[model samples]
Structure formats: structure tokens, C-alpha cells
Target: MNISENELKMMVLKACRGIGLPVAQAQEVAAAMAASPWALKQLLTQLAKPILTASFDFSIGLDIKNAHILRDFWACADAAYLASPRVCIRGVSSCDVTEALARYRGVSVVAQGEDLLVMVDERPMLKPARCEVAPDEWQQLETYAALTYVPETDASRLVGAGAGLTDND
Candidate 1:
């Protein structure tokens, strides 16, 4: 079906919540600046949202509400994800990542699961960045993650249980 930008966001968010991401995170993705693709393209950047999901083992990505990549944006996104599995956490260094996230605009930090959610704003709804978290949250990403979406599972209570928790996630 031809879904609108907002509809697409809702779909992905639903998927995120329904299926659950590998890393711990919320479902809220960056919204379109305007209701139209042109406005979304004009306002947001190519890699606008860098979400760090906590539900999938590998990673997943989706298109921005309306931003259309003239070229093979899929390839570009694939390459980007391939370049780094955990860029927000592994490549950038957790300290740097968190610091950068706090400073970055349109980048929301939310505490959905046991991880931090990092979605790019204005575009690239998918390919979110998830980080290690539990006792503390990714101040920036977690805040957004918490705001974006919520899953339908016991993962929240089951995550990072170690001996204390079970392997429901």
C-alpha cells in the first residue's frame, strides 16, 4: 500500500514494537519535518537519524518519511550499516557517542528497553543506533527512544537480568 510519511513511521514503529529490535530501544523514529516528501527532503539530512535499536541481532533500516535519495540510497544505507554494526557504541566510543548525541540536534535519546535508542532525524527512519545501557540510559538517544515507541513484551523486565533475569529476550 502507498503509505504516507507519517504512516510509514507508524508502520516501522509498529514493527519495532511488535517484533522487537536486537538492541534495547524505543519505537519512536524521527518524524517528517512537514507532511510532504519535498519538505522532509529539504529539511532533514541524508543520515538524519542514526537509531541504535536493541531488538535485532544484526540491524534494520527504513526510509525517511518523504526524503527520497535520487541514487541507490538503499545501497548507501546498506554500506553505512555494513561499515559499522555498532557505530554509536563500537566505533564512536560510548563516551564520545553519548557526548555527541547530547550535542546533536534532532537527535533524540530515549530509554525504551535496556539500551539507548538513536534514530536520525528528518530522514532515514531505519538504521537506528542502539547502545549498551541498564543502570544508566543514553541521555540523548534514550530520551528520544523513550519518546518514540514502546514494544509489547516483557523484555523491559527481562533484559540484563543475567542470573537474576531469564532469557526471554
Candidate 2:
């Protein structure tokens, strides 16, 4: 289905949050996906895998080993953008998503062998107003996002959900 950029961002943010990512990181992923909607599939794939955290050493340049794209990529990109001009990221397979994220964050990323080299750049990213997502992917994303909601129950309805006993307005 076709969705607006903002819709895509909010959905992605909710899905990431539902999958246990912190608010800041979920926002980062959401913005990246909105900037490059084609990366939504990659985001879904990454969410299914276990989250792997990588330590970054910015002594010479940012060196991140075994960085999972969903959990570690945006953090790496932020660090690389702020502290160092270059970053060496290894053990991530989503190069296209990495490149798209770099573009969104105004950085440059290149895949060499099995590593991604990220460098700060001044290029601006172009975002489309609407994104076309496959139905299956949308369903998967919705499944993840639904985890954030409170299930409807009779107790909830009695408390505040629907019309109360005195429905005279």
C-alpha cells in the first residue's frame, strides 16, 4: 500500500520501539527509513534478527566491529558524523540500507569487501512524499507495531475507553 512519508516514519518508529529499541534509536531508524523508504524491507529483516551491540573506538577513526544494522548502524552513523570523519564498520550485511542511512544523515558510505566505510559528507537527501510498501511487509510491520498497544478489555472500557453510564453530552 502507498503511505505518506510521515506515516511510514511513525509506523517504523512504533515497530522499532515495539521490538525493544530505545526511543532515540527508534527515531533514528524511523528517519532513515523515511528518507529512503526502499530500506523498509531491510529494517524488517534486521528487526527479526537478534540485536548485536558493537563497541566504537574513535581513537584514530571510528572502528565498529560486528555491528548489526538495526541496532548499531544509526549509532555508528551519529558518532561518525559528530566525532570522526571516517568510520570502519564490519560484520553487517545491509550495505544498501547503510548507504541510504548515510545519505539521510548527510554522510557517505561505501562497501568494500565485507566492511562499510562511512565518511561525513555535506550532501542533502531527497525524500519522496509517498512510499509504496508491499502488503506482506506492511502486515509484518503492523504486527511488530501492535506490540506497543494496550489490549482492549472490559476493565479498560469501564475505566475510560468508551461511553460511560452517564452518556448525556
Name the top TM-score candidate: 2
Q: lDDT per prediction? A: 0.31, 0.79
Cα displacement (Å) at residue 71, model 1: 28
Question: For residue 85, what is the lDDT in candidate 2?
Answer: 56
| Cα RMSDs, all models | 18.1, 2.2
Residue 161 miss distance in model 1 (angstroms): 36
Q: Please, what's the RMSD in Å of model 1?
A: 18.1
For candidate 1, write residues 39-119 as lDDT tens digits: 222222322334433222345433222212211222223433444323121222122223232222233333333333343
Steric collisions counted per model: 40, 0
TM-score of each: 0.22, 0.86
TM-score for candidate 2, please give it. 0.86
Model 1 segments beyond 4 Å from truth? 21-25, 30-88, 91-169
Residue 58's lDDT within candidate 1 is 40
Tens-digit lDDT track of model 2 for 1-169: 9898889989989999888888887888888888888877777877887666667787876788867676676766777677665678876554556766787778787777887777778887857468899999989999999999998798777886566689787
